[model samples]
Target: MDMIADFDLTAHNTFGLKSTADRAVLIDDAAMLPELAKASAETGRPLKILGGGSNVVLAERLDAIVAIMRIAGRSVNQQTTDATIVTAGAGENWHDFVVWTVDQGIAGLENLAGIPGTVGAAPIQNIGAYGAQLSDFFQSLTAYDLKTGTIETFDAEACRFAYRQSAFKSEPGRYVILTVTLALPRTWKAKRDYAGLDRLPEDATARAVLDHVVALRASKLPDWRVLGNAGSFFHNPVVSAEAARAFEDAPQYPQVDGTVKLSAGWLIEQSGLKGFRLGPAGTYDRHALVLVNHGGATARDIAALATHIRDKVRIRYGVDLVQEPIVL
Candidate 1:
């Protein structure tokens, strides 16, 4: 196990910040994981399981061994009743799979098209947008339990998914997802819950819905690969119906149950932080929620900017917008 030492992790993460990993190895297949487990135990080192590296910010240098999941495959099964059980290897590109599934006429994942990250990390965060979440399509996953060093199956019930939160995140580094099983119907009606999606012209096809979402996201989210961003820096706050009623005159989006969801981006914009800057890190002019690094910036620089926004929102509105990505 000749793991590369002090490897640059800037390119590996979406934020594109300069960072290093003391140990890094690409695990291309599950069959090779047992060997990795043995190697980790031999060295008594904790392993860092990195996937597409979109939803994480490495703030400091780390000495942990990095096991990059590289498993990739797709088995589109018409074997079931008008249902497509598309199982993807953990390392498979997420948006690419979404596009492929849509091409195959699968309907479940159409709303989630264009999200970054690998298949393995999907269920861990229960990634969702545009009236659809990964949990809505997720059936099961095969994970390697680091504690027992054995492969195990986790069903949807066991995932403990909440709004942008999951069991995998709650119990960090316990399960390394290897493959994910998704259930998509060959033909199904789309979910038009959000007013923005509802406002789409009538007779919107699956592709039309996807196109609208992609355009909406593109209009705001800067390309992280080129501009150094991690999509939305904060998760939208969900306040209780009564608490939200206190801000009846204030803007809010209708949410599930009795909850009202306020937009974090709107809050940030209203706080006069749009186009604001701190060192090399700053808020995007078009989208306040997105924090971008203008060419040169450090991890601390971005973190500081995020902290500033959080503080301003808390002070101005008494609402705390939590950071979305994992900050190391």
Candidate 2:
């Protein structure tokens, strides 16, 4: 397998941090991964499977061999009376794929519009937004088992999906996602259970929901292409119902099982950290949930800022906020 040595990863990661991998190989096809895996073992170098890099925070130079997953394609595998199964390659841009499904008159992914990442990374993160999650429509996925170099399939149950998590995430480096197959509804239905989406008109269609979600995301989130960020920095902290009662004025969403999910952004803003800046790394002025790289911030700068934010929130509200991005 051909590889590039000392490859720069500034443009690859969404945060735009200046870091380099010891060596890198672009796997445009899943068939090439077995050889790549063998090469990694022979070279005695660890392998890091990098997707869109939207949910990663690169801390420093990596000594491992970076395997960039560039596998690409998408097609309608089959269609039933009520649902259509759409399969996409791991490299397909997630937002573009969502728009494609909507254009094909397939619903169920509209509320997850505007999310940045590759489709392969979706199941790993169980990516969610508004009211819809990828698991809600996930049918199955094909992945490569790095250890055995064998291809494997996982149903939704096998994926073990939870809120912003999956088996792939819990066991990193064990499997490399190759393709994702989702069963979308033929009969369109708008998901409006989440806050911004809940405010939409009752007659909202799938397209309308997509547009509203896109608009809402664009308004709230800083464009990572312009201003470096990894979307939401922290997961909305879930606490016990009794514990949530202490913060009566805080915005809280009660789950089906009676747990309460508190808004991390609200807690940060309430702590007076909104627009807080230390050089290029700071909490975003418009949305306190986001940590931004203004221009020339490094991973250390961002980490320090995140640590400060987490500490302040923990001391103030007794709620520990966990970061959403994978810190590499």
What would the per-residue lDDT of candidate 2 be over residues 170-279, giving only the tens digit for each residue? Answer: 78888999999999887775777777887888878778999999999998999999999999999999999999999999998999999999999999999999999987
* lDDT values for all models: 0.84, 0.90
58-124, model 1: which lDDT tens digit per residue? 7558667888878989988554776678899999999988888777777678789889999999987
* Model 2 lDDT, residue 223, Cα: 94
Record all residue pairs in model 1 with backbone atoms less than 3 Å apart, i.e. clashing.
none
Best by lDDT: 2
Error of 2 at 326 (Å): 0.4
How much does candidate 1 score in TM-score? 0.93
Please state the error at residue 184 of candidate 2 in Å. 0.8
Question: For model 1, what is the alpha-carbon lDDT of residue 106?
Answer: 74
Residue 326 Cα positional deviation in candidate 1, in Å, after optimal superposition = 0.8
